[model samples]
Target chain A: MALAASGPSERGGGDNLLLATFLEKRENLVLFLAARLRSMATAEDLIQDLYLKVAAMEPGADVRAPAALLYRMAANLMVDHVRSAQRASRRDAQWRLETRVTLGSLDVVSEPAADDALVARQRVRLLAEAVAELPPQMGRAFRLHKLEGRSQAETAEAMGVSRKMIEQHISAAVRRLAERLRT
Target chain B: MTQDGLARAQAAAWVVRLGGDATGEDGVEFDAWLQAAPGNRAAYRRALVLWCEFDARAGDVLAELTAVGAQASARPPAARRSASRLVPPAGRRRSALRWLTPIGGFALAAGLALAVLPPTVLKPATSTTYATGRGQHQRVALGDGSVIDLDAETRLRVTIAGSERRVALAEGQAIFDVVHDARRPFLVQAGGRTVRDVGTQFDVRQRAGELTVTVARGRVEVGSDGSGQPVLLGPGQRLQVDRASVSQLSVVDPAETFSWRAGRLVYRAQPLADVVADLNRQFVEQTVIADPELGKLPITGVIVLDNPRAVMTRLSLMLPIKAVPSDRGLTLLRK
Candidate 1:
């Protein structure tokens, strides 16, 4: 809890003003990046990068709002990270396609252990059953969006319903299924 | 609805939001919701695991669903496109598939869901087992910043639940540095007795059906439910239980019991056999007293456990004894 509040004082006494300020708002930065990146692990990595960049930065800069500058740098880092990840995924997809004919979907599905496979299948069957037992419209929306590959907007258009209505249907359907499967 | 039920419903709503065209604001709100309560995070984690599992098995589940649908109704062509898109032709395969899309947006939340979920869905907890071999000392650092220093020949199983942090000391000893959480009590069950700590540092040792609890900081309650009234122990207090029932409380310097963490065995007028028993745990080669008379000899002073043979040599100098090297261990006899 005191990770941020005490971090600045513990690290830099007075000389490193930027480092102190960064440390002071470190926890806030983590939260902000956590929201933006959607992955806390990636957000943490980005924060570490931000800390390094800030520590090595020139002490005196004509900067207004250090927090804003910090966030701007973090956002740019995230963008770069996302772009690189996308490029990597594209390459990985290309490789998979090239090798697919010989491999024959071998690596596509991970082989769960024998005992675990049975249990997982049973659980999956229960989930499918729960989905089927939902109200017809709600079930259809869930099947189209969640079970199938359709986005909420696409599912809405296919079902001839508003996107908002589809979203409501999905949330309700998921709630019902989770409750049923949990017991 | 119960609080847990509400939390589950909220988690379901968040899952749908994450699945759909979720805005940055929605991500922020979800993060806040996750951090709001431990139960919320637990419920969300449960939901996410199922969500991801379904995503992983989307193809198989869809094939089954389609089969079931065809068996029930004749209208299968209209629903076929959406399901078929999940597994497109090799050339037209989407780089960002179903698994990547949902997981990427909710990646931070997905990691927590990997821990084991017990049968009790309402109070989700992850169980971890920690053990140390002879002459091995280990420090188990928990996610909550609590540190458990396991002594030689120790076996501890920790179950961190929403309501409590529970540990079962099946054998040997461990020093627990419990994180302060008043809402969740840190409890250790050993030798048919339970030791509950309220934000404290304590050492619990259970060897051959005998239990001893020494508190270094804060307070601890030692008892079993419906057995008798539990005794409260504060700093410098120790409680010893024998034969799984009788409890004797005494004043002791907690440092003497906790010194094992520093690799020093400090004893004050303890039996030679008891001292040898502890040494056996700390060394590969065991030490056995040849005669019962020698076993009851009082041992006092510090025994540094850098080397087992050196410890035996030191024991020989301190007492009038001869250390006879045997096939199994060193046998001590009167010189």
Candidate 2:
């Protein structure tokens, strides 16, 4: 529906239309997130966050196209999260190898049978091989983030790079791993 | 598409798949990039399907990985030493292999399986009934300030909220003098399609899957849930939307629609079955037809909704029919 630009009296009409559209399109936006996040619950949470952001926006400000603006905002939020995760991963790796030998010295005994252990070792070997095949920086970011559990900011600091760069690295890492694991 | 265009599409798909929880300005750039090309939208949709497939199997993969990790940890010190040795000094080389190989296999299978399955379908809402017996005209003020004047033997439910205001008519009829609230558009969901209010007064009546909406003032938008398209009705227009079909809009007398709220039931060539259906709600025992064909006979007049028996007597005087109590319910037959 084309929104007519009229006097202040007609502003109410515009607001009503906008609110209606928002309600109708909110689910579509959530579906958009769920497709990417792979988790409906997480997507729902993000939609809630988006709702708060959208609701708080100044109404008087001219939103030339509400749908496009909403999508743009949602996209920016996702990118920021990816970047932070990247940074966290890098920092985690440095911490794991440098200050974490306690697990190595543990005297825990095994409970599982030999066959299970053998199978596990093989899986880890497969996983290791996959990571090894990743592009250098991307692989490092994934390890520090996923395996080591470092904060994205810390990972970025350890890598001595911008947070955005770290996110890009992780995204590439995940894509490559997802592709490689398929075979 | 160019490699750069493809990359951006992939990134956008990831952002959406992640539920937009990812950080950085890449999501914004990715969105802009996706909109930049029609090809990008198509690629993103493909990636989205793959992402959903991977997501469904994420639980299984995580469980398997945890089991593997536990197994690795349980091994003797010597085995861990050998495993650690296999990890190259360059962490990058090791990480690439760690995530790529196993995850890729499961994700691809899961994606293909999910794609082959049909999309999920949502079931229609189960209806709840609200009815008033014969000879009783009740006025109900809804939560949203809209008032409903239920004619005798009418059944309806009012569901109102900030997001949506809906009324489901099970049987009988009601006159709605709806309060104007733009934020919450009022609608009567009955007979598959919804009679949506566009800041107007209207009356809706439903009987045996046959329903009608009469707009006295303002406008109404009528459309089925499956079809998003709506037919808008202006003031003084009456439309019949039923399971069988929707009738052409006819200019109606606004008073004829509002007469029920004023304690009078007005009928114009309406069936005996419909008149009895209206009476059943206003009266406890209800009027029934002895002959099946008699129920289909038409009647046209104004019945002052007062005493149930009095209305029935008046109805019998106008038509050659007499009311009789049967084992099932009240019955009416030719005199």
Candidate 3:
């Protein structure tokens, strides 16, 4: 049950290569799926389905380039989900937006220091301030992806920028936010 | 970059890279980097914590962005320049829908001026601030025939220039009936998001880190501030952007959303916590759910914005709950 082993050095990168690649990109794949599917919860579900797909792979399956195959598989799974989910979601478009996707179980409330309501509010204020402080382009990028839950591709499309640019902006945004909130 | 900055940047890059491309060489490289230095792992952990926080509180962050963005943009130049650094891309076309949501059934909050809607009266540029205290509602009529109904404990700033009609909802809820003057489009710059009217009537409510926009008439476009794909909401459609998360579209009865102006809060299948938060704003005395699980109870009824005691008494009969006197106000306990 070793979910991941370091690179190809550990036991000649045989059976675990695909699983390792899948494990490494699991979080990123969620983003990739979320952007296309417009739902984090669904993306998570797909990631699980992907894990099963990878886990069930023959141990001796001589697969060349596991990463590309893994992503392609994820993309295909996403298409399947989207095709099926479209009719059901649209027909029942009576849902609200409080769907809390526990990405890695980000237990922010577990912090002992900010236990009080006031401290939590102040922390939000700080976060908002840092985000608001970002330049318009970067700020919009952060809002659309982080705040609005748009995929980097969708965000790029919305901002009329390249997907690479959206990624860069998000990276920069995370860097800037971390720096500002460090204190 | 400084040593710490280098680590932070690398950490951010790894986190972001994983979001886009974490497989193949990228994954191996990241693994090597982590093992290469102790500081690298620490840096990555630090960035991850922050990233996770953003993911967890995405809704709150967005709402706060709107609430904070409203105030940041409205602050005097001295404060504004230091905060945002760059100005709003004024270069972006200001062509907006002048349709501010109108309070069709409510009177003016300031003074009962003209009961008749004002014609398209061109006026000198001015900025006006309208706010409501607890247990108070105000209807504000702008010169452009557009009307806004301010709910309790709401504050908004209205600035009408020769070219644009902008309202920043710092906090609270407001229904807008904007007049269709294409020349001066009505744009509501909330926190970090903008609800631009498309010759439509809509309600924009920003609370905590969540924003709910329900379009009652015509259509409105809700987008993150400055730029991004604006979500077009049509009549009887509601878009709820919960703290930096998903912009959930739902079929809602517009009457339920707009009923607040008529002195009754209409809710259909909303959580009891959401209902209580709304009540707390309307009344001086607050209602606290002693049981966190009790807050998740679905409430579907109309609550008159009268005294808290009367409202609670009526609510208790409808639901299995009892109100006990507490220091802050009344705590709702299971019967």
Interface RMSD of structure candidate 1 (Å): 20.8
Q: What is the DockQ of candidate 3?
A: 0.15
TM-score of chain A of 1: 0.51
For B51-80, candidate 3 gives per-residue lDDT tens digits of 767765654555455433222222223322
By TM-score, the candidates rank as: 3, 1, 2
lDDT of 2 by residue, B13-120 (tens): 364334334432333344455556566555555445444443343222333333333222222233223434222233332232243222321111111110111111
Candidates 1 and 3, the one with greater TM-score: 3
RMSD of 3: 17.8
Instruction: Identify the candidate with maximal DockQ.
Output: 3
Question: Per-residue lDDT tens digits of candidate 3, residues A1-183?
Answer: 333433443334446778767777676566555533445677789999999999998765665666566767887776676667643442112111232211122312233343574586678778877887887778878876775455678778767899989988988998899888886
TM-score of chain A of each: 0.51, 0.43, 0.50
- TM value for model 3: 0.42
TM-score of each: 0.41, 0.37, 0.42
Please state the error at residue A37 of candidate 3 in Å: 54
Candidate 3 residue B122 C-alpha distance from true site, Å: 11
lDDT minimum window of 10 residues, candidate 1 chain A: A92-101
Model 1 quality (TM-score): 0.41
Cα RMSD of all models vs. native, in order, equals: 25.4, 32.2, 17.8
Worst 10 residues of 3 chain A by lDDT: A90-99
Docking class for model 2 is incorrect
